[model samples]
Target: MPRHLLKLSDLAPAEARQIVLRASALKRQADSGYRPFVGKTLAMIFTKNSTRTRVSFEAGMARFGGHALFLAAGATQIGRDEPLRDTAQVLSRMCSAVMIRNDSQRDQEEFAAHSRVPVINGLSDLHHPCQLLADLQTWFEHRGDPRGKVAAWIGDGNNVCHSFIEAATLFGFTLRIAAPAGYQPDAAVMGAAGDAAQLADSPAAAARGADLIVTDTWTSMGQEAEQQKRLQAFAGYQVDAALMQLAKPDAIFLHCLPAHRGEEVAAEVIDGPQSLIYDEAENRLWAQMALLEFLFGIAA
Candidate 1:
């Protein structure tokens, strides 16, 4: 059986680098119309609606000559019908691997807990492992190698922030996370990232001398109810022209997309020359392909 990658920390820095290198190779082969995962089947379950997650995983599987079975929450007995353990047991028997995009981080743990096969986390409240894979891959591609680079994460320290911190520590980058006074990353997650050089402070403070700076929506999907409150909390946290000026002149800005232009990140920055957001989004496919190749025993 293949090893399950349930979190960014699941792979050591070396293993994570291997994942990216393998993905790049696979992408080249795939782009040239090679298909290696013939006769394989991957099961994807989503309790949350997806844009890139669904398309990337499905397209990535197909790129390798595999089939992806996308299951909606209502189609399966996840939370509403059968227990998660039972669901996991059943799916593990029928599928080579399972990728789940759900709500709680605990649900991901429960799914990985019962499944004997490789269980991948598509997203959760606390982490998004696939994204970190892409983020790392992007950094690797842009800089050819991310060693010794100072990466900064600006704006709200949400789930993406948590996952980014963990990836930073694992990949050995000096990760500086800048959020507002009351919007710091979860202390437990921060402790878990294990970055000796990780620093959390204001956006400008983190941006200084950073090679990569990232931001995400101040208000996430499930937190629409707290939109006003989040706006107030994240008021001056925007990654605008002035803030970008604080970073290294060659520093690149990153956003996970569906960016609320003029809000969390300004329209000019997200669409500007310094932004690598589109490349970051494109890396999602290559990154997940790399991860899926490993989970499916495809030699990543």
Candidate 2:
């Protein structure tokens, strides 16, 4: 049986910590020409569009001397309704591993269930463990271990927010999330976080005294149809300079990116000195490289 990362909860706390630590080390030696995955090949399947997820994984594999095969779901047999199990079995036989960015978590889980190779959830509707890994690595780089720290999430309680809830449980942090009534995170995810996660009455309440503040685009990829309604619902949820002022003086800001300047955040906040969005984006490559190494049992 092969280990698979279907969600953040799939990794034990210690394992998650190890991967983050290894990612930092890998970042330091990024140009050292260490190629543990010299002969390996990664099959990347994308059912949804991506920027960071695709480039980071592809570049990470190439950096490790491995090749990556990009398979657009629409262009593959899987688009024609070839069973996920069949695709999983065939890919597992040839690729060193598989990474999938899709709409359904259940589909990814089903595919992973049939895969002999390690299956990584690049992104899904329910969770985004890869982004969490890089986000944690960025936090660790700036502010040491996050255990006991406070993070504020202001916006739609979508996949990224859900992953943050899981990360709060695994990393022992408190996450304050502020979302509109119908847009809040899944009850099951929050329940799993126990006291680590909390619902805030407003963005101001969530950001108050927080060490890290984060938000995402009000309209996600699949939610284009709901843009106008979402804009109205999330009116007071933007993480602007005023909202950021409620946080600690030294608090940092993060967005998973392609940010909507005036919608989820202010241009000043995203491009300001307190923003770590660029570092967070760059860390995706290093963090994912470490993840690939961990999945393949390569030496640190």
Candidate 3:
């Protein structure tokens, strides 16, 4: 059976590590003038607007010598009366692969369940697998190894945070997430991460000696209406200079871009020294390109 990248943890530790290695090789090959997806077509399904995810996937397919067809939710019958399963069943036969960015994992899972082609989860409320690929790639590029390093997150344990926890557990890293009471990660994710954080007394204590410090917006896009409330709930959890200084001196700061100026993170810390965010953003394209090739089982 063909595999899909819906959640980072869905992959075994070995599989996740191989994706990072494969993604790196793909990056080097692309830089050296190799294009593999020539004449092929990729169907992209977007339920939300995006800057990085949109351009990265489109450019990735194109760089591999393929054409990416951008399909919007508004333009499809999905917005009117069509079922997601029906859409997936139909699209599977028309495109080589289907990449979807929507609000929920349930939607993507159902789509993949009904489709014969590979279903790439572009982004979901539960996980951002591709983004984490770029993130892990950047970590290796800058920090050398992910094993046993402390990577602390201080903010809402949203999609990105949860994915980081999963990655840390899978890769045997010390991941410390400091979120307010109501904004903690899911119980299952926390349990898995706890099983992996045995290197330290506890997860929070594990973050004290981290080599990387990461964070995200206090509230995501669709949660704008709850912005003020989130700010109040996430107080004292900002990744400001003081908090960032808690990590090792060489620690790198990462964010997925389109960051909030003062919420969750300070502007200087994100735009200043030790920030690997630009490379992180650039790696999104390369990492995703490699992921597609791997899922397709292209000749090594």
Please give the ranking of all candidate structures by TM-score, highest first, separated by commas.
2, 1, 3
**In model 1, what are the clashing residue pairs, if there are any?**
none
Residue pairs in clash, model 3: none
**lDDT per residue, candidate 1, 45-153, as tens digits?**
9888899889998988887788899999887776476888999899989887889888888888888888978888888888888888888787777777777788888
TM-score of each: 0.95, 0.99, 0.94
After superposing candidate 2, which stretches have Cα over 4 Å from the reference? none
- How do the residues 1-300 of candidate 3 rate in per-residue lDDT, one tens digit apiece? 668788888789987888788887887777766778886678999998899998999999988888899999899898895998899889988888899999989999988998878899888898888889899999998778789777887777788877887888778787777777778887777776775533333334545668988888888889999988998988777777876676788989999878887876788888898888899999999888888887887865
Which numbered prediction scores highest in lDDT against the true structure? 2
* Residue-level error in angstroms, candidate 1, position 41: 1.4
Instruction: Name the Cα RMSD for model 2.
Output: 0.6
Model 2, range 52-83, lDDT digits (tens) per residue? 99999999999889999999999999999999
List ranges where model 1 is wrong by over 4 Å: 194-197
Deviating ranges (above 4 Å) for candidate 3: 197-207
Cα lDDT for residue 151, model 2? 99
Candidate whose TM-score is highest: 2
Error of 3 at 255 (Å): 0.6
Could you arrange the candidates by lDDT from highest to lowest? Answer: 2, 3, 1
